[model samples]
Target: MTSPRRWTLRTENTGYTVRLSPDGPWAELDAWGPLGVEDGPSALDWSRRTHFITPADAAPAEYLPYGLRPFAGADLVASRPGEERGVWWDFEAVEEAAGSLRLAFADDVIGLRAVLCYSTVPGTDVILRWTELTCTGDRELRLERIDSAGVTVPVSGPARLTYLTGQWSQEFQHTQLDLPRGTFTMGSQQAVPGHAYAPWLAVQDGASEAAYGVALEWSGNWHMTAEAEPGGAVRVRAGRVPHEGAVFLAPGETLTTPRLACAFSPDGLDGLSRVWHRYERHLAGERLRRPRKVLYNSWEATGFDVDAAGQLELAKVAADIGAELFVVDDGWFPGRADDTGGLGDWYPDPAAFPQGFGRFVEEVRALGLDFGLWVEPEAVSPNSRLYAEHPEWVYRIDGRPARLVRNQLLLDLGRTDVQDFVIATLDRLLTEHAVSYLKWDMNRPPTERGRPGADHADHLDLDAQHVAGYLRVLDHLRAAHPHVTVEGCAGGGGRIEHATLARTDVVWPSDNTAPLDRLSIQYGFLHAHAPHVMSSWVTDAPGVFDPRPRSLAFRFVNAMCGVLGIGADLRAWTGEQRAEAARWIARYKDVRDVVHHADVRLLGTPADPTFGVQYDDPAAGRTVVAALSTGRLDGAPLVPGRPERLRLRGLDPRARYHDAESGSTYSGAHLLHYGLPFAWSADHDADLVVLTRQ
Candidate 1:
């Protein structure tokens, strides 16, 4: 038998092929989808050249040896110890394992080795890629521009790119652009990921269907580029951002880049998103088995005026409405009446909680709710006790002043004392109180990221070290207090990545809980993260900045799509409103399991007059669809022209499903082919449809 020219890595129900050209230039991704080839190898060609076009206007004119090639993104970009020319690597070896493949390449002249690694989860289409570079020569290597991995897809007709961009309070706004054969890029060098661009990008075949996507798993500064080559082929490159400084490696030293996950789907962008959800659950391991509590956070209700009596009143109402966890956010800490002070002081305000957290915890527990506290361990207000005692603890350049963001300076996690302080403080809090959950908030990025006692030569990369230190603190807390769950919130959605997700049980996508605006925010968030980890809250009407007065049902239905939380001030609600909220909470509990473990599908975009999400768990034989209608402004009573029917997806066509609400049974074939009629009145209407395999 002849050796296969193309090798296939078969995943769950998808196949990805790596083909080597007969001319022996480079290995290219020939195909990636449900079928290995859409038509034939000739139709989906992979015979493109590996070299760059000479003096191209879009790229460097000098033809940087390791830069933009016609077929694939550069895997490695580095020069010798004292040279400016990038090393030219030739493919050497390929190895295959259980669910992984490793490709090794080498630069003979410079004696540098580069290895490209690819791995996939057992039952998902996501292919993870990363790079390892090492010097085999007898000299040191100065490295710059090292990307984890890159892949290219050939387009047939009109193509478009979909991505997300937003600010602090308005994060994860879904946006798209027509692919007109140019380079599109997003990156962050602010020491942490930015609110403007999420580390994810998708390329769709015009109709916003049949898509391919890539998401970087790094938490530190990172960059992702999607360049549309002239001939309808788009290449994507992503990895850690080399913004701090160039890396130097002595002979025999090796550096590994962060993992970049790529997936393809024939069913559209929603299908592609489902694969990511599955992959994340697989990584979540035991955490997936634990049921997420119906949390009630008191941040919006009692911002800085948190007193024991106020929290107790909220906890009683929260428990009455089925909240299992009650979190006191921000104001509980000493001197923390406002954002400008008391960030580093992690203890309860002496006057507010005269007896400390003991009585408050007992009261919340007495109301059948678990207690939680908010802490900004990585940030310090200059006026606080922690900063006043150790001013050198904050990140700062030798003589320059420490820059403040949100009236706080980022603690130099690189220092042993600072790290110790964070860990010890958290350990004491968890040990002292009946705190079942922690709202870990890092409100700002590192500024003047330089340490005082450390030498510049060795401690120049303080930002990266700070990230590691932050992760270390979480690891320690998890080990020390296994029962405590941490919710990662970096000024609302700023610190999102696979690494951070791995440590925390949940993430706050944004502080803005206005139901109308959140529809779009949640749409973009779920594209890259699992719904179980995305924290969605239902607060009061006429949200913070948005003037839309959404019905309580609309807010509950929207928040139910994720790990549901109630941030509304139940204390002020009428008896009828409280009863209604209780019923919604009960309904959420009925399908919480399915919501947490199911494969989510984005039913329609926020741009559509009707927006919603569908959760389907084939194995569990459960399906839940939550749809919200954008009603017209004219105070019309009835839903304008009737509600649009929702077409069910991910159903077994031959099986039967029974709708609980209508008490009707329908064939899976009919439900999948046709859509179920939704009942609603006026606008801003919301409904939760539940079905079971029967």
Candidate 2:
């Protein structure tokens, strides 16, 4: 009964240890030194008590180990009697065994360092990639790779220095490195510019469950640009530069990058396209915008009691089933919503829109669609009105009063006027309506609160300073609504990160609108995110609580793999289910620019009875396969083969094709050796094979 050894690494002189072998691969490492003994006798006070060791283990009442300082041009150089000399340690165990486990520390002359990686990728959730560094002592360094759910990828060239940070957990989280251009002066003070290392990474199924490792994807402020080559050498480029991936460095050399974290177990999309090609090569030179209105919601369709003409009649049946955005979930907000109460009162509920929310955003933009709203804005409702006009903005413990879940509380996002009233009430509802989209949500689970004198094992550094004040209220709503479009709903797949997808584009993912639970939660959120940021919809077909009707071609083959929403109500379907939901939302708006920019291939197994295909052809030699079937078995009769002759991978394999779903086509070697008849049914369902190349 022991197949779980996935990973482990260890080191010490006051720090370093990692272990994860509960069920795959293998990892175990340990290094140690300083423990106790100090009696004040010269030799630099017995070499600072044999180079430090004061961690007696306690912290973790919900995590708060923010302590370890010395990485900003780290220089101690030599110590023994308990070691501690320039300090160096590194760790990584990610061949996508649910990507995570990256420990690092650096000393020996400044280049900033204090990083952490902790994802446990099961259904693509888990985050923590916090960073605060400042380096440029010249040896090359640049890394802007933020993941674990807050997407920012960009890593420029030349980096080689390794491991810094000297000391251990005092409830960790205090960083300050300025590296004014490097030279050294920690005695007369002035040398405070670059060098601060306290690195970490862990995701070999990160501690397992708790809804998968509590959010983090390179949390907050990541930027390191340096250049001073030719001898004193210092060349670095890190990414997320103006929004695109980047990485470049030079020191002792070691940069393997690509670890967004994933795990579906029932194993499908396994390693999900190498964690979506390391988050699309750290968002390789950005520019891919597409979310003016790609939706499908229904609180799972009619859950909280819908209303407001039953949600404008399900936004005119999701704009006659083609939908271009029409949200409206949670019974139209205000003190006492259907779910219970208007969580954190963002307002709007003159009896569920008796004319207001700008006339329900001009009647869902006069039926052409394009209006969305559903906010949690950090949470409040203890019968709200901003918690009865600020009950010290929530997050308590001092006098106790702060424990209520779902009926709600939370809202003390480490206060800065509660991140300026959640960025001025979501920028006054995107400047009084015409709202383009928001969703947002957060639900709960941060618990109690402590940081006012810390010690309750330091409430996870005040919950990472209220998740860096909810990313400074989403960088002030993307600097005041850069053309709306939010999404990001926690409590439903909880805040998947890369720092909340660099201020969100889309997420929602789970209210479980059954298309077989979104084909196993979007094959585990397209393994680390970005199948047009996955949202998925089409609800209310015998799945209000599992009656099992399914089919609408297995719910548009799992809402055509995402960003398509329609929470059923189109005046109650049935015109052949509204022409098969407007012919699969017009074939997902004609292959959504190759499913929001191509390159994905899975084929089968979420527990294989066989039926799971996903191929995309980005222009040059066109191709697109989707197939499905994890149901039918034993009755037999469902066998339709012809992936033309299937064997395509990244395409252009000598072009020449044509089967935009069967006009008879072949080549790319007869569709990669003729193997594509996917017939495994509970009445015949699931298929999406488009191949073009006249």
Candidate 3:
């Protein structure tokens, strides 16, 4: 027998090896880590203690069904009408490429074939994995659980897990915990990926800096569970459209699971973030390097009192403040006097734009700025004309009452008819106004989530359908309206994933823009995602979430860390504040390229009194740093004996550096060793320092 074959998949710096023995019915992950790991004895080659349970149950099974691995949790679960739930599949065939692999397993009796798919992203340390299930028999099969991939991490004892979790106003809070035993799981039951938790997980040995990360690309209901088996092996399983009963698989019909992207980093979670960012940029393609304009949004300024004159006034101030794109946020549509109405309506309110919507958009553009608009396409208020005309378009059970959150019902995006209407609505708006930027928002999740007329309501898999239809519409936007830039938001950071990042130019992190609160939120966000896709805004100071007094300079530095946007009502700003905003905006544009496309390192977390981010680009000959004092400082900004300092990273020790703002020069060795000194006063707590290497 040909030794069941073994394949090693290589990314830029890591290697993952899987083995299938001719004697066993299942495959196992032999090794995973640095490139040369497979050249030596696999760490998994150990003595087996499989006395009571089968080898498939004791081994690190890649992906298995119930019967063969009856003890452990299974990856695939299926059943025939009058048959058992177990699927005893046998390894059948495999297809391998330079950086890709596909393993097939078939259960002849059940007439089902499952294929595990794997491929490496070209330029990054990321491997995308998914699954394909084909029903080969005449009778339809019910698929209860079909996961994308099963990841096995070999460990001696406990493993550490890191994930992002938070709620509506406070999203993307970095969380970490120990997985010493049992199973830890996180997921979203809402039709959309809710604000509860992001579909991402990272596992590392105890305190080791080396980390392995897995993120689901599906923006629908999903689950990621990490199980630390009794034998000291940690296994993670992830999938989308989950916990919703089952789906019917007819003969010859195949269902492809969503891709689960896997990444590795030797330098820790911070390093792992760059891996994710690189892959996101790879996913973005041409949109990656595109200039992210300095934007000004008119939501907090005008609110529902939007009108032709008020917006133009704001536009003049925005253009004067160096805003490249001007966005008219919510309350622009008819019937939208408040959040309780005018959600589904696509056209602009004639009363607000009596001069005509087309002319208003052109007028905003006339101020040397690109015009933008915000729309929540997947929601409908009871008072909306679209909802009144097509009440059946929303998700609802036949005779059940619909629950309304935020006075709106989520549209059934799964339906092709609904997708068509959404596409048509957005296309018309973009075409009529010649809009250059679009902010697509979804305010609520599905409550009923039912298709009234479906034959097998239990097997509908509404989440999958909705997600597919949503991606379809996004694809149409990319193809048909390629000239328009898109920003994705689900209330705020609720629906962020690779799929959304691939399609949209940026995403809103949170609704709370108070400096200190937003600083922590952006800190957690940059740990898991890249800066290019992060849309940070500077709103009014000392408002709402955090009432702590913060300088406008602090607010600008906080927002400038990402794609800078001024959400504050500039018309209300004093002349000094407006001038300061213009200066900061100009400075951001000067170093925006390095900030967006350079090596980023976060120094001292929010826990430290002075924490900030460093962006370094040797090719650009620029190194920018934004340091903010989050806690109380001692007497004197520049203490005689102990000056507040921040040690820089990724700098040559022997090189000389010049400070653009202060005309100060120092050795890179001294800057990196003793650190750069900050003379921050009580009112001046933050600074954006630019350094040029000489």
Candidate 4:
């Protein structure tokens, strides 16, 4: 007889509304779409439906606990020592503060409280949701699983899910499937967010262009499970610090789950990408103002033979070719002729660098290029003195042989002593040298993740503690040495997420830098992350994933799409090739601002005969399109046809544009309708075309 109580949340362009069901205090999503859609009846209200599951289970509640979410999986699972694994919670209070909304529920009998939190990511069509569980009872409770938030998409018919999946060097391969029924699950348990799958998902209503996206903001083990309900609603639940068993929660202590960002886009997956990009840029804030530098890393050139004379030689050529930063990769530490040793030895190898590390850095600075170094701080090799002295620091299960991944053992970062040691190591290096950049890489996930203590198996929240330690070190770097740029890498693209992105300047996309393979990797990466944070390298490796021998220009254009880096051995390149790289670097500096800050649009995928990334900067009256021909072509004609053109979007039709290369002019209307013509052929496989509004 009485109308249900309701609450509506809105971002710049979208809206989300939830209401209390008439039969119970539990909430259900009423409306979630464009602005001004909050006044209608909620499609997920259980009061309007008939039969099936419990009231809380049937209703599309925002967040529910164990006993309440009976038949279905609960967002929060908890239990006391000898009690049943469930809770009968009732709505207690709702609070709104500082643009954030919170709803609290309490189970008086169990002495537990759950708070669902929501806040809009300012200036964007995205809202972040998370949960906090507090132990209110006198006895401690165990939390087996606590998800950030449960999102219910108001969909009819089936839901199409889009996600990224792959391994190690071949990460971020976009994959999609239609789910007419049942549930789909994806996650990582390898301590760090593993390479098998990323913690992100996008759901579309059948074939509609409108879509909803969810991304978990966590660097540790996480999970995302999406289910297509029988009644046509799609529900997604995600969280972090996923453990095999319950983690103890003491009285008066509160555990907060990772934030799950929910976004809405009306223009399709491409448009949804812009929403995510804008949010990431917002997260960067003042850091976004800093330019993405063109760097030259000396990893592929001289692996373990990192001597001062050889490094200085490479630095001279790097400076000549317009590299702003010069990084000396691994194998620069003592006892480190190969990957088998010298991991924990942080000091520069005296034998390899007879001219002192500081002097080597000064020599690089004299060449007009900033100095950088690579360090893997969380791993220890048995051959190193640090590990030999403190072998207990490495993670190991008692009575079990230690597992070695990449010939190194993972440091138990959960220990405060280990965290302090890592901080001291990086701090001393940056303070002693004039290092402008630091490439922090993690080569492998923790294999035997265990603490040496007896109580750790059930009492210690190892994953959560390790993540906190990692973030603390990165935060220390950002605050203590603001001048240093930090590049985050975990065997390439393994540890990328919002929490890591907040503290680091850039992330290595993958170890597979082959032209076509990298293009595919970057294509999927840009959809979820901003380009400024994607560190792309032009390497001469003989194809780790793709074997196609693409031209130098093709490699340059592909790497230019993100923060450009050169890892090829410069001395091995021909004079003409060196000259060509210099030209491309010069050209890149001209359009780097637009490329980094502009709204990026992925024209087509690498699978297409002709695909490109279009950077549209309307405010600056400029657009840079790095078009590439991936498929086979002939001089007589482009693979598909000379008539094939890339129709541009998000431009004013009345404006006229001038092409920098051809010196030709065209109306914005013409470019939007017809598009930029690509003269693709055997000789010209790729072109970085810049256009200025006239």
After aligning candidate 3 to the native by TM-score, how far in Å is the CA of 445 from where it should be? 0.8
Please write out the lDDT profile of model 3 over residues 188-250, one tens digit for every residue: 988667787988999988746789999999889888989998777789999975535777898
Per-residue lDDT, model 4, residue 581, is 96
Model 3 poorest 10 in a row by lDDT: 634-643
How does model 2 fare in lDDT? 0.49
State each candidate's clash count.
Answer: 4, 111, 0, 0
Candidate 4 per-residue C-alpha lDDT over 1-694 given as tens digits, one digit per residue, 9 for 90 to 100 = 0132667788889888766666665656778889987765666654445466776776677888888887777888889977889988888887765557787889988889888888988889999999889999999998888889999986777889999989988999999988998999999988877788888899998857998999999999998999888767889989975554677889998999899999999988899999999998888889888898899999999998899999999999999999999999998899888889989989998888787888888989999998999999999998889988998898888888998888989998878899999999998999898988999999878877777764753587878989999998999999999989999999998999999999998999788888888988999998898899999988897667778788899999999998999999998998899999999999999998898889999987898888989998989899999998888654455234455578888878999999968988889899899998887767688989899998
Compose the digit string of candidate 1's lDDT tens values, residues 1-694: 0145556777777777776544434556666777545336533453344345432212211111263242334545677756764676677888887778887778877878877787877778888888788889987776766778767766775568888899988888888887767778898887768788888888886743678888887778888887776656677778786546666667898988888888888877788788888888876778778889999999888889999999898998999889899999988877777888988888877799877669878978999998998888888889988888998888877878777788889888867788999999998999888999999987787767777766755425565567778888988977888788789998899888888887788999998899988877898998878999989999984665556677889999999989999998888899998998999999999999998898898877877767768888888888898988764545444335653677777788889889878898888888777766765665448888898998
Give lDDT per model, in order: 0.78, 0.49, 0.86, 0.87
What lDDT does candidate 3 reach at residue 34? Answer: 81
Reference-based TM-score, model 3: 0.97
What's the CA RMSD of model 1 in angstroms? 3.3
> For candidate 3, what's the RMSD?
1.9
